[model samples]
Target: MSIYEKIGGEAAVDAAVDIFYRKVLADDRINEFFDTVDMESQHTKQKAFLTMAFGGPNSYTGKDMREAHKNMKLTEDHFNAVAENLVATLQDLNVGQEEIDAIIAVCLTVKDDVLNV
Candidate 1:
Protein backbone atom coordinates (compact mmCIF):
# COMPACT_ATOMS: atom_id res chain seq x y z
CA MET A 1 0.00 0.00 0.00
CA SER A 2 1.02 3.59 -0.56
CA ILE A 3 2.47 5.45 2.40
CA TYR A 4 -0.51 7.75 2.21
CA GLU A 5 -2.94 4.92 2.69
CA LYS A 6 -0.74 3.31 5.27
CA ILE A 7 -0.74 6.50 7.28
CA GLY A 8 -4.45 7.34 7.02
CA GLY A 9 -4.43 9.25 3.73
CA GLU A 10 -5.92 12.71 3.35
CA ALA A 11 -6.58 13.47 6.96
CA ALA A 12 -3.07 12.44 7.91
CA VAL A 13 -1.53 14.56 5.20
CA ASP A 14 -3.60 17.53 6.29
CA ALA A 15 -2.57 17.18 9.88
CA ALA A 16 1.08 16.72 9.06
CA VAL A 17 1.15 19.79 6.84
CA ASP A 18 -0.45 21.96 9.46
CA ILE A 19 1.85 20.78 12.21
CA PHE A 20 4.89 20.92 10.00
CA TYR A 21 4.24 24.50 9.04
CA ARG A 22 3.77 25.51 12.62
CA LYS A 23 7.14 24.00 13.46
CA VAL A 24 8.77 25.58 10.44
CA LEU A 25 7.43 28.98 11.28
CA ALA A 26 8.64 28.66 14.82
CA ASP A 27 12.05 27.47 13.74
CA ASP A 28 14.54 30.29 13.67
CA ARG A 29 16.85 28.24 11.52
CA ILE A 30 14.66 28.39 8.40
CA ASN A 31 11.76 30.64 9.19
CA GLU A 32 13.27 33.54 7.30
CA PHE A 33 12.64 31.76 4.02
CA PHE A 34 8.94 32.05 4.67
CA ASP A 35 8.91 35.62 5.90
CA THR A 36 6.95 36.99 2.94
CA VAL A 37 5.14 33.84 2.01
CA ASP A 38 1.39 33.58 1.97
CA MET A 39 1.22 30.72 4.46
CA GLU A 40 -2.36 29.72 3.68
CA SER A 41 -1.45 29.21 0.05
CA GLN A 42 1.76 27.53 1.05
CA HIS A 43 -0.10 25.14 3.28
CA THR A 44 -2.39 24.15 0.45
CA LYS A 45 0.51 23.63 -1.90
CA GLN A 46 2.37 21.58 0.71
CA LYS A 47 -0.62 19.32 1.25
CA ALA A 48 -0.84 18.64 -2.47
CA PHE A 49 2.90 18.13 -2.74
CA LEU A 50 3.09 15.71 0.17
CA THR A 51 0.05 13.81 -1.02
CA MET A 52 1.63 13.36 -4.41
CA ALA A 53 5.01 12.51 -2.89
CA PHE A 54 3.45 9.89 -0.67
CA GLY A 55 1.83 8.22 -3.68
CA GLY A 56 -1.65 9.32 -2.95
CA PRO A 57 -3.77 11.48 -5.29
CA ASN A 58 -1.62 13.55 -7.63
CA SER A 59 -3.35 16.91 -7.79
CA TYR A 60 -0.04 18.72 -7.44
CA THR A 61 0.83 21.02 -10.31
CA GLY A 62 3.37 23.23 -8.64
CA LYS A 63 6.78 24.09 -10.01
CA ASP A 64 9.48 21.50 -9.96
CA MET A 65 11.69 21.54 -6.85
CA ARG A 66 14.53 23.32 -8.63
CA GLU A 67 12.38 26.09 -9.97
CA ALA A 68 10.33 26.36 -6.83
CA HIS A 69 13.33 26.93 -4.54
CA LYS A 70 15.92 28.21 -6.99
CA ASN A 71 16.00 31.74 -5.68
CA MET A 72 16.13 30.72 -2.03
CA LYS A 73 19.82 29.82 -1.98
CA LEU A 74 19.11 26.89 0.26
CA THR A 75 22.06 25.05 1.75
CA GLU A 76 22.54 21.63 3.23
CA ASP A 77 21.90 23.05 6.69
CA HIS A 78 18.61 24.53 5.58
CA PHE A 79 17.63 21.28 3.98
CA ASN A 80 18.56 19.38 7.11
CA ALA A 81 16.55 21.77 9.21
CA VAL A 82 13.48 21.16 7.13
CA ALA A 83 14.07 17.44 7.23
CA GLU A 84 14.38 17.56 10.96
CA ASN A 85 11.11 19.41 11.24
CA LEU A 86 9.43 16.89 8.96
CA VAL A 87 10.70 14.00 11.04
CA ALA A 88 9.48 15.72 14.15
CA THR A 89 6.10 16.27 12.60
CA LEU A 90 5.74 12.65 11.65
CA GLN A 91 6.89 11.52 15.06
CA ASP A 92 4.41 13.87 16.69
CA LEU A 93 1.64 12.21 14.73
CA ASN A 94 2.78 8.78 15.94
CA VAL A 95 3.80 7.58 12.51
CA GLY A 96 6.05 4.55 12.65
CA GLN A 97 9.81 4.83 12.18
CA GLU A 98 9.73 2.83 8.98
CA GLU A 99 7.13 5.10 7.43
CA ILE A 100 9.00 8.21 8.54
CA ASP A 101 12.18 6.86 7.04
CA ALA A 102 10.33 6.08 3.82
CA ILE A 103 8.83 9.54 3.71
CA ILE A 104 12.23 11.14 4.25
CA ALA A 105 13.74 8.99 1.56
CA VAL A 106 11.26 10.45 -0.87
CA CYS A 107 12.10 13.96 0.31
CA LEU A 108 15.80 13.27 -0.14
CA THR A 109 15.22 12.50 -3.81
CA VAL A 110 14.57 16.22 -4.34
CA LYS A 111 17.37 17.50 -2.14
CA ASP A 112 19.70 18.46 -4.94
CA ASP A 113 16.87 20.05 -6.84
CA VAL A 114 15.73 22.05 -3.84
CA LEU A 115 19.27 23.21 -3.23
CA ASN A 116 19.63 23.96 -6.96
CA VAL A 117 22.95 22.18 -7.01
Candidate 2:
Protein backbone atom coordinates (compact mmCIF):
# COMPACT_ATOMS: atom_id res chain seq x y z
CA MET A 1 0.00 0.00 0.00
CA SER A 2 1.02 3.60 -0.54
CA ILE A 3 2.14 5.70 2.41
CA TYR A 4 -1.14 7.52 2.21
CA GLU A 5 -3.00 4.24 2.50
CA LYS A 6 -0.70 3.21 5.30
CA ILE A 7 -1.54 6.36 7.21
CA GLY A 8 -5.29 5.81 6.76
CA GLY A 9 -5.71 7.73 3.50
CA GLU A 10 -8.01 10.70 2.94
CA ALA A 11 -9.64 10.67 6.34
CA ALA A 12 -6.27 10.86 8.05
CA VAL A 13 -5.07 13.61 5.75
CA ASP A 14 -8.22 15.57 6.47
CA ALA A 15 -7.75 15.32 10.20
CA ALA A 16 -4.07 16.25 9.97
CA VAL A 17 -4.80 19.34 7.92
CA ASP A 18 -7.51 20.42 10.33
CA ILE A 19 -5.30 20.00 13.35
CA PHE A 20 -2.28 21.39 11.55
CA TYR A 21 -3.98 24.63 10.60
CA ARG A 22 -5.41 25.11 14.05
CA LYS A 23 -1.92 24.98 15.50
CA VAL A 24 -0.58 27.19 12.73
CA LEU A 25 -3.17 29.87 13.26
CA ALA A 26 -2.45 29.89 16.94
CA ASP A 27 1.28 30.12 16.40
CA ASP A 28 2.60 33.63 16.75
CA ARG A 29 5.54 32.79 14.54
CA ILE A 30 3.35 32.17 11.51
CA ASN A 31 -0.15 33.37 12.31
CA GLU A 32 0.52 36.81 10.87
CA PHE A 33 1.02 35.34 7.42
CA PHE A 34 -2.48 33.88 7.51
CA ASP A 35 -4.30 36.88 8.92
CA THR A 36 -5.68 37.89 5.54
CA VAL A 37 -6.28 34.34 4.36
CA ASP A 38 -9.66 32.69 4.11
CA MET A 39 -8.87 29.72 6.34
CA GLU A 40 -11.91 27.65 5.36
CA SER A 41 -10.84 27.75 1.75
CA GLN A 42 -7.23 27.25 2.72
CA HIS A 43 -8.21 24.23 4.75
CA THR A 44 -9.88 22.66 1.74
CA LYS A 45 -6.85 23.38 -0.44
CA GLN A 46 -4.47 21.91 2.11
CA LYS A 47 -6.51 18.75 2.28
CA ALA A 48 -6.16 18.32 -1.45
CA PHE A 49 -2.47 19.27 -1.50
CA LEU A 50 -1.55 16.85 1.26
CA THR A 51 -3.73 14.14 -0.22
CA MET A 52 -1.63 14.23 -3.36
CA ALA A 53 1.64 14.65 -1.50
CA PHE A 54 0.94 11.57 0.56
CA GLY A 55 0.28 9.57 -2.64
CA GLY A 56 -3.44 9.32 -2.30
CA PRO A 57 -4.49 10.97 -5.61
CA ASN A 58 -3.32 13.68 -7.98
CA SER A 59 -6.28 15.90 -7.25
CA TYR A 60 -4.77 19.13 -6.01
CA THR A 61 -6.03 21.99 -8.16
CA GLY A 62 -4.25 24.86 -6.47
CA LYS A 63 -1.35 26.95 -7.68
CA ASP A 64 2.07 25.37 -7.87
CA MET A 65 4.23 25.82 -4.79
CA ARG A 66 6.63 28.36 -6.23
CA GLU A 67 3.88 30.43 -7.78
CA ALA A 68 1.75 30.20 -4.68
CA HIS A 69 4.44 31.35 -2.31
CA LYS A 70 6.28 33.68 -4.63
CA ASN A 71 6.95 37.19 -3.37
CA MET A 72 5.82 36.11 0.09
CA LYS A 73 9.38 36.67 1.46
CA LEU A 74 9.28 33.39 3.30
CA THR A 75 12.29 32.72 5.47
CA GLU A 76 13.76 29.51 6.79
CA ASP A 77 12.35 30.30 10.22
CA HIS A 78 8.85 30.45 8.79
CA PHE A 79 9.43 27.22 6.95
CA ASN A 80 10.71 25.53 10.10
CA ALA A 81 7.70 26.75 12.04
CA VAL A 82 5.38 25.23 9.48
CA ALA A 83 7.33 21.99 9.56
CA GLU A 84 7.15 21.89 13.29
CA ASN A 85 3.40 22.44 13.16
CA LEU A 86 3.02 19.53 10.77
CA VAL A 87 5.12 17.23 12.94
CA ALA A 88 3.26 18.20 16.08
CA THR A 89 -0.07 17.71 14.38
CA LEU A 90 0.82 14.21 13.19
CA GLN A 91 2.24 13.31 16.56
CA ASP A 92 -0.90 14.52 18.28
CA LEU A 93 -2.94 12.31 15.97
CA ASN A 94 -0.85 9.31 17.06
CA VAL A 95 0.80 8.82 13.69
CA GLY A 96 3.89 6.65 14.02
CA GLN A 97 7.41 8.09 13.77
CA GLU A 98 8.28 6.15 10.65
CA GLU A 99 5.28 7.50 8.80
CA ILE A 100 5.97 10.99 10.05
CA ASP A 101 9.57 10.69 8.88
CA ALA A 102 8.45 9.65 5.43
CA ILE A 103 5.96 12.48 5.28
CA ILE A 104 8.59 14.97 6.37
CA ALA A 105 10.95 13.72 3.72
CA VAL A 106 8.36 14.38 1.06
CA CYS A 107 7.71 17.79 2.51
CA LEU A 108 11.40 18.63 2.60
CA THR A 109 11.64 18.00 -1.11
CA VAL A 110 9.25 20.90 -1.65
CA LYS A 111 11.04 23.33 0.61
CA ASP A 112 12.94 25.08 -2.15
CA ASP A 113 9.80 25.47 -4.21
CA VAL A 114 7.71 26.70 -1.34
CA LEU A 115 10.41 29.11 -0.31
CA ASN A 116 10.83 30.33 -3.89
CA VAL A 117 14.53 29.72 -3.57
Candidate 3:
Protein backbone atom coordinates (compact mmCIF):
# COMPACT_ATOMS: atom_id res chain seq x y z
CA MET A 1 0.00 0.00 0.00
CA SER A 2 1.09 3.58 -0.60
CA ILE A 3 2.31 5.56 2.40
CA TYR A 4 -0.85 7.61 2.16
CA GLU A 5 -3.01 4.52 2.41
CA LYS A 6 -0.92 3.12 5.18
CA ILE A 7 -1.43 6.27 7.23
CA GLY A 8 -5.25 6.40 7.10
CA GLY A 9 -5.45 8.11 3.74
CA GLU A 10 -7.22 11.34 2.88
CA ALA A 11 -8.84 11.99 6.20
CA ALA A 12 -5.51 11.72 7.95
CA VAL A 13 -3.79 13.93 5.45
CA ASP A 14 -6.54 16.50 5.67
CA ALA A 15 -6.31 16.60 9.41
CA ALA A 16 -2.56 16.98 9.32
CA VAL A 17 -2.77 19.78 6.79
CA ASP A 18 -5.38 21.64 8.79
CA ILE A 19 -3.46 21.49 12.00
CA PHE A 20 -0.18 22.29 10.31
CA TYR A 21 -1.56 25.38 8.60
CA ARG A 22 -3.24 26.64 11.70
CA LYS A 23 0.12 26.70 13.44
CA VAL A 24 1.82 28.19 10.42
CA LEU A 25 -0.68 30.99 9.96
CA ALA A 26 -0.69 31.91 13.59
CA ASP A 27 3.07 32.00 13.72
CA ASP A 28 4.19 35.59 13.46
CA ARG A 29 7.56 34.48 12.17
CA ILE A 30 6.26 32.82 9.03
CA ASN A 31 2.89 34.45 8.38
CA GLU A 32 4.38 37.06 6.11
CA PHE A 33 5.37 34.46 3.55
CA PHE A 34 1.73 33.50 3.19
CA ASP A 35 0.21 36.95 3.40
CA THR A 36 -0.28 37.23 -0.34
CA VAL A 37 -1.93 33.92 -1.10
CA ASP A 38 -5.59 33.10 -0.77
CA MET A 39 -5.63 30.74 2.19
CA GLU A 40 -8.44 28.54 0.89
CA SER A 41 -6.51 27.84 -2.27
CA GLN A 42 -3.31 27.45 -0.29
CA HIS A 43 -4.94 24.85 1.89
CA THR A 44 -6.28 23.00 -1.11
CA LYS A 45 -2.91 22.96 -2.81
CA GLN A 46 -1.14 21.89 0.37
CA LYS A 47 -3.48 18.93 0.81
CA ALA A 48 -3.01 17.96 -2.79
CA PHE A 49 0.75 18.18 -2.50
CA LEU A 50 0.87 16.15 0.68
CA THR A 51 -1.48 13.59 -0.83
CA MET A 52 0.78 13.06 -3.78
CA ALA A 53 4.01 13.28 -1.86
CA PHE A 54 3.00 10.41 0.36
CA GLY A 55 2.18 8.16 -2.61
CA GLY A 56 -1.53 8.91 -2.73
CA PRO A 57 -3.44 8.70 -6.01
CA ASN A 58 -3.62 12.43 -6.56
CA SER A 59 -1.18 14.09 -8.95
CA TYR A 60 0.59 17.12 -7.53
CA THR A 61 1.20 19.25 -10.57
CA GLY A 62 2.10 22.22 -8.45
CA LYS A 63 5.21 24.19 -9.22
CA ASP A 64 8.54 22.68 -8.27
CA MET A 65 9.17 23.35 -4.60
CA ARG A 66 12.43 25.13 -5.23
CA GLU A 67 10.92 27.44 -7.78
CA ALA A 68 7.77 27.91 -5.77
CA HIS A 69 9.76 29.02 -2.77
CA LYS A 70 12.55 30.78 -4.62
CA ASN A 71 10.97 34.18 -4.52
CA MET A 72 10.59 33.97 -0.78
CA LYS A 73 14.33 33.68 -0.23
CA LEU A 74 13.76 30.79 2.10
CA THR A 75 16.57 29.97 4.46
CA GLU A 76 17.46 26.96 6.59
CA ASP A 77 16.09 28.77 9.65
CA HIS A 78 12.71 29.27 8.01
CA PHE A 79 12.59 25.69 6.87
CA ASN A 80 13.47 24.46 10.36
CA ALA A 81 10.77 26.66 11.84
CA VAL A 82 8.21 25.19 9.48
CA ALA A 83 9.44 21.70 10.20
CA GLU A 84 9.18 22.39 13.90
CA ASN A 85 5.63 23.55 13.50
CA LEU A 86 4.76 20.47 11.46
CA VAL A 87 6.27 18.17 14.04
CA ALA A 88 4.44 19.93 16.84
CA THR A 89 1.20 19.75 14.91
CA LEU A 90 1.59 16.03 14.43
CA GLN A 91 2.31 15.60 18.10
CA ASP A 92 -0.77 17.64 19.02
CA LEU A 93 -2.88 15.45 16.75
CA ASN A 94 -1.64 12.37 18.58
CA VAL A 95 -0.27 10.77 15.49
CA GLY A 96 2.02 7.84 16.13
CA GLN A 97 5.70 8.49 16.66
CA GLU A 98 6.52 6.31 13.66
CA GLU A 99 4.10 8.26 11.52
CA ILE A 100 5.54 11.52 12.75
CA ASP A 101 9.02 10.27 11.88
CA ALA A 102 7.82 9.21 8.48
CA ILE A 103 6.39 12.65 7.83
CA ILE A 104 9.62 14.26 8.96
CA ALA A 105 11.58 11.94 6.73
CA VAL A 106 9.50 12.97 3.78
CA CYS A 107 9.88 16.62 4.63
CA LEU A 108 13.64 16.17 4.90
CA THR A 109 13.64 14.59 1.48
CA VAL A 110 12.20 17.78 0.12
CA LYS A 111 14.39 20.18 2.07
CA ASP A 112 16.69 20.86 -0.81
CA ASP A 113 13.72 22.08 -2.75
CA VAL A 114 12.26 24.18 0.05
CA LEU A 115 15.49 25.61 1.41
CA ASN A 116 18.13 27.05 -0.86
CA VAL A 117 19.80 28.90 1.94
Candidate 4:
Protein backbone atom coordinates (compact mmCIF):
# COMPACT_ATOMS: atom_id res chain seq x y z
CA MET A 1 0.00 0.00 0.00
CA SER A 2 1.06 3.56 -0.58
CA ILE A 3 2.01 5.62 2.45
CA TYR A 4 -1.25 7.44 1.96
CA GLU A 5 -3.13 4.18 2.33
CA LYS A 6 -1.06 3.18 5.28
CA ILE A 7 -1.82 6.50 6.93
CA GLY A 8 -5.56 6.05 6.32
CA GLY A 9 -5.85 7.75 2.95
CA GLU A 10 -8.50 10.28 2.08
CA ALA A 11 -10.45 10.36 5.29
CA ALA A 12 -7.35 10.65 7.41
CA VAL A 13 -5.76 13.34 5.30
CA ASP A 14 -8.98 15.33 5.32
CA ALA A 15 -9.30 15.09 9.05
CA ALA A 16 -5.68 15.98 9.64
CA VAL A 17 -6.01 19.09 7.49
CA ASP A 18 -9.07 20.19 9.37
CA ILE A 19 -7.52 19.61 12.75
CA PHE A 20 -4.19 21.07 11.75
CA TYR A 21 -5.72 24.32 10.53
CA ARG A 22 -7.69 24.74 13.69
CA LYS A 23 -4.45 24.62 15.60
CA VAL A 24 -2.76 27.02 13.21
CA LEU A 25 -5.54 29.54 13.36
CA ALA A 26 -5.66 29.39 17.09
CA ASP A 27 -1.98 30.01 17.34
CA ASP A 28 -1.17 33.68 17.82
CA ARG A 29 2.24 33.26 16.27
CA ILE A 30 0.91 32.24 12.86
CA ASN A 31 -2.62 33.53 12.90
CA GLU A 32 -1.66 36.90 11.45
CA PHE A 33 -0.72 35.34 8.13
CA PHE A 34 -4.26 34.09 7.69
CA ASP A 35 -6.14 37.17 8.82
CA THR A 36 -7.49 38.04 5.41
CA VAL A 37 -7.35 34.58 3.85
CA ASP A 38 -10.24 32.47 2.75
CA MET A 39 -9.98 29.43 4.95
CA GLU A 40 -12.45 27.19 3.14
CA SER A 41 -10.56 27.56 -0.08
CA GLN A 42 -7.26 27.15 1.71
CA HIS A 43 -8.59 23.97 3.29
CA THR A 44 -9.50 22.54 -0.06
CA LYS A 45 -6.13 23.39 -1.49
CA GLN A 46 -4.28 21.94 1.46
CA LYS A 47 -6.24 18.71 1.28
CA ALA A 48 -5.41 18.15 -2.36
CA PHE A 49 -1.78 19.12 -1.89
CA LEU A 50 -1.21 16.83 1.07
CA THR A 51 -3.03 13.94 -0.59
CA MET A 52 -0.68 14.14 -3.55
CA ALA A 53 2.35 14.64 -1.33
CA PHE A 54 1.61 11.54 0.68
CA GLY A 55 1.56 9.31 -2.41
CA GLY A 56 -2.16 9.47 -2.96
CA PRO A 57 -4.11 9.81 -6.19
CA ASN A 58 -4.89 13.52 -6.34
CA SER A 59 -3.82 16.31 -8.60
CA TYR A 60 -2.72 19.40 -6.71
CA THR A 61 -3.28 22.33 -8.99
CA GLY A 62 -2.68 25.13 -6.52
CA LYS A 63 0.20 27.59 -6.78
CA ASP A 64 3.62 26.09 -6.29
CA MET A 65 4.97 26.25 -2.75
CA ARG A 66 7.48 29.00 -3.42
CA GLU A 67 5.01 31.17 -5.29
CA ALA A 68 2.28 30.51 -2.79
CA HIS A 69 4.46 31.61 0.10
CA LYS A 70 6.81 34.00 -1.62
CA ASN A 71 5.16 37.15 -0.41
CA MET A 72 4.74 36.00 3.13
CA LYS A 73 8.38 36.49 4.14
CA LEU A 74 8.00 33.32 6.14
CA THR A 75 10.62 32.29 8.64
CA GLU A 76 11.72 28.96 10.07
CA ASP A 77 9.70 29.70 13.20
CA HIS A 78 6.51 30.02 11.16
CA PHE A 79 7.28 26.80 9.35
CA ASN A 80 8.01 24.99 12.59
CA ALA A 81 4.75 26.20 14.09
CA VAL A 82 2.80 24.91 11.13
CA ALA A 83 4.68 21.61 11.16
CA GLU A 84 4.08 21.22 14.87
CA ASN A 85 0.37 21.60 14.34
CA LEU A 86 0.45 18.97 11.63
CA VAL A 87 2.38 16.53 13.76
CA ALA A 88 0.10 17.11 16.72
CA THR A 89 -3.00 16.65 14.62
CA LEU A 90 -1.74 13.36 13.25
CA GLN A 91 -0.73 12.19 16.69
CA ASP A 92 -4.12 13.18 18.04
CA LEU A 93 -5.66 10.95 15.40
CA ASN A 94 -3.30 8.13 16.40
CA VAL A 95 -1.22 7.97 13.27
CA GLY A 96 1.91 5.89 13.90
CA GLN A 97 5.33 7.42 14.50
CA GLU A 98 6.72 5.93 11.30
CA GLU A 99 3.95 7.47 9.29
CA ILE A 100 4.25 10.76 11.12
CA ASP A 101 7.97 10.78 10.48
CA ALA A 102 7.36 10.18 6.81
CA ILE A 103 4.82 12.97 6.78
CA ILE A 104 7.24 15.34 8.52
CA ALA A 105 9.98 14.43 6.12
CA VAL A 106 7.79 15.16 3.16
CA CYS A 107 6.83 18.47 4.67
CA LEU A 108 10.46 19.34 5.32
CA THR A 109 11.36 18.87 1.70
CA VAL A 110 9.46 22.05 0.91
CA LYS A 111 10.89 24.10 3.75
CA ASP A 112 13.28 26.10 1.64
CA ASP A 113 10.61 26.82 -0.90
CA VAL A 114 8.17 27.80 1.79
CA LEU A 115 10.67 30.13 3.39
CA ASN A 116 11.85 31.40 0.03
CA VAL A 117 15.38 30.87 1.29
Best by TM-score: 1
lDDT of 1: 0.86
- Give per-model TM-scores: 0.92, 0.91, 0.84, 0.90
Model 1 Cα displacement at 86 (Å)? 0.5
CA lDDT scores, all candidates in order: 0.86, 0.84, 0.78, 0.83
Give per-residue CA lDDT, model 2, range 1-117, as digits (tens). 988999898889988888888999999999998999888898887787677667788744334888888999999999999989988998998988998888888788788888888
Q: Select the stronger candidate by TM-score from 2 and 3.
A: 2
Q: lDDT tens digits, residues 1-117, model 1?
A: 899999999999988899988999999999998999998898987787678666688743324777888778899999999999989998999999999889888888778888888
Candidate 3 ranges beyond 4 A from true positions: 58-63
Clashing pairs in 2: none
Clashes of 4: 0
2 or 4: which has the higher TM-score?
2
lDDT of 3 by residue, 54-83 (tens): 567864432477777776788788888888
Candidate 4 ranges with C-alpha deviation above 4 Å: 58-63
Model 4 residue 60 distance off true place after TM-score fit, in angstroms: 4.7
Native RMSD of candidate 2 (Å): 1.9
TM-score-based ranking: 1, 2, 4, 3
CA lDDT of 36 in candidate 2? 95
Choose the strongest candidate by lDDT. 1
- Spell out the clash pairs found in candidate 1: none
